[model samples]
Target: MRDTALGAPNGAALPASDVSAAVGLVGLAGLLAWIAICRSFPEFVGAFDLALPAERLDGPYAALTGLIAAGLPMVLWSVFVDKVHTRDSTGLDWNKRAEGQSTRAISFTKLTGLWATWAIIAAVYCIARWYWEGNYLFAMQILGVAIVPMVVLSVPYILWLDRRMFQPRDGAWHFGAFLLAREPWDREKIIGHWRAWIIKGFFGAFMISILPGGFTQVVNADFGLLASQPGALASALIALLFVIDVQIGTVGYITTMRPLDSHIRSGNPFLAGWLAALLCYPPVNYGLMSAGGLLDYEINAPGWQHWLAGNSMLLSLWGGWMVVLTAVYAWATVAFGLRFSNLTYRGVITNGPYRFTRHPAYVAKNLFWWSASLPFLVTSGGPMEALRNVVALSLVSGIYYWRARTEEAHLLREDAKYREYHAWMAQHGVVTAPLVALGRAIGRGRGEVLQPAE
Candidate 1:
């Protein structure tokens, strides 16, 4: 087995690998130190209110000591464990062969060193927490410290065990094999395109962050409601929504990562602009809402009718806008599908909202954010709320313009048909069509009028 896919590029320095390993070890050490020091002082734990009940502390402390004792042997084994590369298939033979292998031995030593350090740190933290009465705090700290190494060790262990138990054949390593096995529709090119846009969307969100503060200030100032009152509940809800949106966005990203990796492997661009847009926009909107006091859900009023009337109209508008944007996104996705396919040379996705605006999903995203801000305009109870809406709208519009430009550039490269699309849009004025047409007409008549006057 050549393992060509896993091999490093020719002439590449191995120093990069060494440096990464060193950094990982250093980080592990730092985390251990932090846990140890924090656990040492009872007063420190008391200051943070981490102290635990007197009766329950001893058992946990004993358990912590036992864990440390048990982990020490594994740590020592890790230190001695060495890798051997040879034509032989037997595991023990490979280990014996690696007895003098410098690189393999060093790697194992480092791993074992870190494992021992982590185990000891965990023991110290647990002991401190149990005897010192900050049991919960100690447990949280221990769990946090344990997580990274657990992940590092568990993943490899499972993979190795799986290989030995089920597929004992040589040359069976396939990156993203799990994803490929599950989703036959997963294509490499589409994943690459989607990943590229994900990066772009994240950058765009960062840009959007800069302008929302002014919008938030304006909205908060105008609403006249005290921050501690009716505004609080609204603000809290807005924040909660933003958090949910971020969590979902993260889920979407995870769901797509493996596919994107596969797409890159196949030298393709998986262009899912609408999907990326939907994932990225909600966070930006939530952040803006929080900044504008719209998320402060603590404040409530007795006039249910007023609240209903105000919020109802805004919600309706938002819903309508969402529909419109969704339609547009669908159209874009469909229209550009062929071009994206030709460029990245990959899969076809014609389901769900795809029948609508080629990029209906992206459009839905735009509508969602825009509509989300409407409550600030109507229920905000002050001028600041109105200002927040205006500012948010402007920022969103700017983001769309930026996104459109990038999307168009990508389209042009992927498909010549995009040139014609651009020309058509220019002619129709797209979003700014009326203004552009008016300008052209005025420019044409002005020359004649000026010549006649002269």
Candidate 2:
């Protein structure tokens, strides 16, 4: 259940519009960083206490904008790749196929019932979590920022989109009403997504949590990117791109990941999912990164080097990698478009950033984390601390390494084409193949290939 992200010309890695979009995102990041540096917006030091009504709306509003942004590439896909206007892919053009259409029609009653059930569950979870030590205000905020957007705006918009793009001639396809409805679950679904709803809910809630502070960064005249001061430059980069990626990635996740590929074909091993999920959520994502009040929640990478001051040349280096890191994350996720998910193999992507490497997202992310951590050297810190940092950071990187390896193995086993693809990528990748071979050699060729079913 995947859609083609590319209508690329003759196996090209990127289309012309993609280049434009990438350039545009990067330019926007640079400008926003500059503004944050020049203006010192929102005064994050004062936190939400200083936020006005407009600033408060930034997060949820960003979610709206992100969904719109996700649609641009998708709309392009429709026009150029899918050519949906003149032809419907649901086989709706033939009125003679009512039986298949009948099976496809989502029951309005069932959909409404399921949504009501989920709504009640989500509300109860929100409320009970409050009693179980969740913040009441945060719960309310979740309702406003996350849940409300999903129900009132996001869900309906998607349903309408389904009606617009994939409607059957007899109007039998009601799966629009069943947008969040479950398809058939595979074994992998049993464990990796123990908290699927909560994760998605929070994932959606992130825009709500992040956007206002981003606006505040602008408002406070913390103007992001500026000349000369590397410290201010880094702050600006974090202040801006940090917000942008979440919007872009979240939109990608919702548009493609949630609606299109929620059904995981394979679950990652426990270690892979645990470590990745940990980095994605709380204390790790923000606790170590933030310098002040609302600053904590921003997606900005903290010190690649934990011991250094915020205003340091070392962190500036980390910032460069951070940019690469975020860009790669976006590239990989966007390539999947509608197939993005954590700890799951729903589809294989061969174009875009993926053409360069089999594990672009994990590789880029690990590089970013390592650069941020500044391990094995006393570049700005003592040897003991550096050594300790190296060990901890290495562990985190290792998790991703396992993720990449396991992901390949799982994908290869699941799809025969992916197996051929694995062989091809291993032979052809400019940078990744040799690196993978080297890793295999170091592991004594362990995990190099799967055994033939014992």
Candidate 3:
């Protein structure tokens, strides 16, 4: 009952968490409002890069296959793991009735309010995206029929789930955050403090949600090329890479390692961690990335050749390099496995692909993008213009590089292992040693301040 490491028995209420959640809820509402405003005034829509081409709907099949294949197993395994952890010695689910009553501070009203707010945001995004894709009638149906009823219907369900799965019953929270009264030791522990856990869950759900669409991309590309394309070998290799990525993701989340118990926490709450994480994900990217005038496949079927033009040899080479990058990316993920999630450290992974470079995924991913983009293929502009566009498109890689630095900073602060890893990578990494020296030289004017992290 006495105050201890985690918190006091009668722990002071987390007003800060409440405030942060409230701010998040309000910010989401405002984002929805922006979508609505853009929808109502089409002129304003041009100012924001919120539009996605209706034709791009053709999708990528091989990528989709990877996502569906990988995602289902992870979800199933996570559920199985949950069941195993929540069971008692006699094989019963741990009871939380008393714990739910006394230890819980979150009430029904709070949970419902948060969910309802999210419902509004979802409804707005559905309408905005559909409308952007020029499907006005479908957008209307979603608003008039689906969003209205779902918001109304979700209240009771939200209350039930929050109580059963999500509410913090003891000091620890379940992945589903269910209410329980047993010893906190028995509960499934998430990686961070309660606030950070909430943030991680938000992004984790984002990762799961994108799998189907990502898989569809692979399906589209592989099947689309199967009949007409000459480079069957390249296509097959690409498909294999997607499968590897899925496998790596599943491996990371299943570990029982001490550091891998929870994903990493956000070191910088604002720009470095959460904001950067959001920018890295999709739908969100549809809004943030369009402004950079970077090269992307926003054009439809016939028009894509204008931007994506290349001979079969070039295309096959591009596909091959992409697969190689995906392999490196998968290797990184395999080491990270279940610990893999954006903006939070589930744990520091120093083995596997990481020993060769601190950021295998980022490096490989950027190279794959460059290969696929083929900025050398000018679509409609002069050589100078094409070069400028390529440079701009390359900035996308810079964004990931920034993300890598931020992640390093976060891990370095939280785990001394990361600092050691950084030093070792600078001196001994197969791929990173040269870059490390160049980076230090770039900052040579600052005086010899780069010392080893002890």
Clashes of each: 58, 31, 34
Count of backbone collisions within predicted model 2: 31
Prediction 1 global C-alpha lDDT: 0.34
**In model 3, where do residues sit more than 4 Å from their true spots?**
1-198, 214-240, 243-260, 263-270, 291-315, 445-454
Weakest 10 consecutive residues of candidate 1 by summed lDDT = 14-23
Residue 240, candidate 3: Cα error in Å is 5.4
- Residue 207 CA error for candidate 1 (Å)? 21
Residue 112 CA displacement from its true place in model 2, Å: 6.0
Each candidate's lDDT (Cα)? 0.34, 0.48, 0.47
Query: Candidate 2 — what's its lDDT?
Result: 0.48
After superposing candidate 1 on the true structure, give the runs of residues whose Cα lies further than 4 Å from its correct spot: 1-363, 375-381, 420-454
Q: Rank all candidate structures by their lDDT, best first, as comma-separated numbers.
A: 2, 3, 1
**lDDT of candidate 3 over 91-197, digit per residue (tens):** 22234333444433443434433444455455555555533443233334333454466566655543343344433332233422333332233332433334453
Q: Write the residue-wise lDDT of candidate 1 on 1-454 in tens digits.
A: 2213222233322121101122222222332342334234355556677755322122333334322332233223223331111212122122332222433323333334334444554565455433234224443544565568775974444333333222221111221322234322224433453344444333322322222232222223322353334433343334322322222222222221121211211222334444323433344345443444443321222223244344655444444444455444433333221112212222223333332223344455555555544434454357765565566555555555444444544554553333433333333323433444565567678762110000
Runs of candidate 2 with Cα error greater than 4 angstroms are 1-66, 69-73, 76-81, 84-109, 120-124, 127-199, 206-208, 215-225, 256-280, 283-322, 376-382, 440-454
Q: Pick the candidate with the highest TM-score.
A: 2
lDDT of 2 by residue, 17-60 (tens): 21123432442344344344323324553454654432322433
